[model samples]
Target: MIGPNLIPVGIAGLGSYSPKRILTNWDLEQIVETSDEWIFQRTGIRERRIAEDGEDSGKMGAVAALRALEDAKLSSDRIDLILCATTTPDKPFPTTACHIQNAIGAKNAGGFDINSACSGFVFAFNTAAQFIATGMAKRVLVVGTEKLSTILNYEDRNTCILFGDGAGAMVLSPLDEAGRGEYLGGSIQTEGGKDDVLEVPAGGSTLPTDKRVLEAGLNKMVMGGNRVYRFAVSTFVKLVRQAVEPYGFEQLGRIVPHQVNQRIIESALEKLDLPPETAFSNIHKFGNTSAASVPMAFDEAYREDCLIKGKLACSVAFGAGLSWGHFLVRW
Candidate 1:
């Protein structure tokens, strides 16, 4: 059932970045009533990097993007588009991708930012793939960067211990042949009815910032942990199967899931009947870095030679917007 017009898009290069500041579980104990053992057993997170003062999403993204371009052995002038996926953007106007374009001196490209929370990267990847598939762009930079530490409610142990800041980018280019790209098949799904389960209550058009909201700290992230946990585990398992079944499940070589939490990841593996070692994770070191998790893991796995050429690798993630999806890549 392959479409006659189907085209391929492959990753030419990859790069990632994390801020200098490292916040450890012991650091959390100093601020909250949590123990290192409790956090380790619960989330498998020992430490996470925090963006330094004045370091915004765009800056982190630009650094990662530059590395990706360099790795691809391409100059900024060759890039045709930039897609930055982030929830913690620098501002509401100008879009973070535009700022990245200017910072990286990619004057030849025009771009936009996408917000699907932790699922942002998969969403961006799918979007960028379409641009190449339809012959709209040649070289596209797809970046997933976030400075979640900026908006975290430090006083809330439930949320504060679960987030960090970082950025990761990939250089994707069009491939003339079918089934010969960095990715093969993927799908995205959203459940707006569950939006309230994880969201920032203020500072949006629906609930503009006010003195009362600001004083109440309503702008910070809020999460119904149990609800999101349930949804994340189920969605990840379901969509992963959806993406892999089409390619023949037995052909899969490895799984690279979003570094959200150890428990959720373990649950996903259990449900899928896949071994734990088949999945690459860095949540213990980076916590939940939102969109950056997958690419960061991708870079690390690639370096460790966990993702080999012509091997089937599947990436899955779930996040705010109650969105979730998976992508099957031929590495």
Candidate 2:
């Protein structure tokens, strides 16, 4: 697992935000043909957040980004790059990152969007780290945010019950001169042939949005549950191994996995023979926030003192396009 050399990068700060509106399983039962017990048994998500009308991904992302900058004790002007990892952009032409940059007053930063679905945060973080590692950017802000409720088909109990809205952000910069920060590289794999396994069936370039697409629900997310469950379990195990192999078992401090499903995390970790405590899960509170899951969970673990400066932390995720990725950082 020894990999190519990389310049060390550091996590400058972290912050996250979930909407105030909570949609519990009981509430879901009233709207959809599902039960709390059934949802709990399968997904382990007791509740999830939903944005109020007019609160889009960009707005939520802006708040999280500001908090992240505050945590790092830096101003918005210091940010030279803003990478937003999201699937539910406010619009296709103006990226959610653009709105966030302006909202947070990051006038000096160049902003863009990354749409790798659930794996977006991990992908964006690694991409932003390279900027610091190669001296392309001094300070970067990476945010994983989603407004999945906007694109969910409530009539479909399967997909509707599994998604939520939220955002998580992190600040990245060159390692401190004291050599306290480190960035260990990770791996990513994609199975394009399996792209149809999980995705929004329409609303993209090929399947441009139309009244028919909207009426048919093709514009919303549709997943092959059985296929995705199997893929996720195997992919999680593979990504975790790649994420930890470079540092060995002893140096592996913690794993912050995407909160897609509690059962998926449990099954994968059990197969890997790692104790449940080694991984973190917030699905019960946040549900499947797509790109927001990993970073949101990582922030919770960090606040509890689990992710310390000398300890290593690995975050991994899997999502649409059959994409999966791992990212390791030393806080």
Candidate 3:
């Protein structure tokens, strides 16, 4: 199941949605001890989108999925599977995928959710691709949606400045022999041992929410930025190297990576001897939308014409399972 029986898969359509609210660095400047310049220099992010009180990942993802369906010239009922990737869902029960499916009127679509923190979208995309490849499905909708603003501890400037809320969706269908492009090979890996370095202290079975947990400030996100940064850079470089292997960077049209940090992307690309221009990033505008980062970047790059049809693209991401993975595609 792991090797050699590959089948060609390609992106059929793409769309992304971002909330209307703008949270500028200057706005954050008033809330924390940080300045716009400091935040820019450190994360290469100037602003990010914030979901309104009633907005959730499901709502945003449904919008994105509808747009993708429109882009592909397909109807919602045509989709065979729907995969929702997110860290922040509207509720604990009724997976976000169900919400999107219901919202979009995708009665025929079987759906579920995936939580790989930031690396979720790519993981979901590849998993859906495999289903198509195996002849188990014909059309799949994969969405990376996040309401990170809800979980973030605004008091912690370190984590607050690094995330945002958004959703990105893409349609996947098998490619014919003469199709314009194909999804080549890629890898997904995680280092569970390193989970302690980055996590939310409570709200899960390990530390269910209680007044004490709330009073102790254990219900929000917590991150060891320095350690995560180090791991990010190393894991990023390794994934790229492994993904490119025999095919090589020269065959790639662009590298759309998880928008965790500009510095990490730049450093990892530099370490890999890859050109700066080859990396496509929208972090400056959206910060890190966790699982939404890679797909959001992909959608933006496609809109900007950076992701031209018939060109190869590599998507790499690292997130909280201490999860890190990469996928290759041709647009």
Per-candidate Cα lDDT values, in order, are 0.87, 0.87, 0.87
1-331: candidate 2 lDDT, tens digit per residue: 1135645688887889999999999999999999999999999999999999999999999988888888888999999999999999999978899999989999999989999999899899889988878789989999999999989999899899999999999898877821433677766666786767888888888899999998888988888868989988999998888777666877777889999899999999999889998888889989999998877898788788776667678888998888989888765
User: Which segments of model 1 are wrong by more than 4 Å?
Assistant: 176-181
Show model 2 residue runs off by greater than 4 Å. 1-6, 177-181
Tell me how candidate 2 scores on lDDT. Answer: 0.87
TM-score of each: 0.96, 0.96, 0.96
> Which residue pairs clash within candidate 3?
none
For residues 12-120, what per-residue lDDT tens digits would candidate 3 score against the true structure? 7888999999999999989988999999999999999999988999999999998888877789999999999998988887999999999999999998999999889
lDDT of 1 at 242: 81
In model 2, the Cα lDDT at residue 198 comes to 80
lDDT of 3: 0.87
lDDT of 1: 0.87
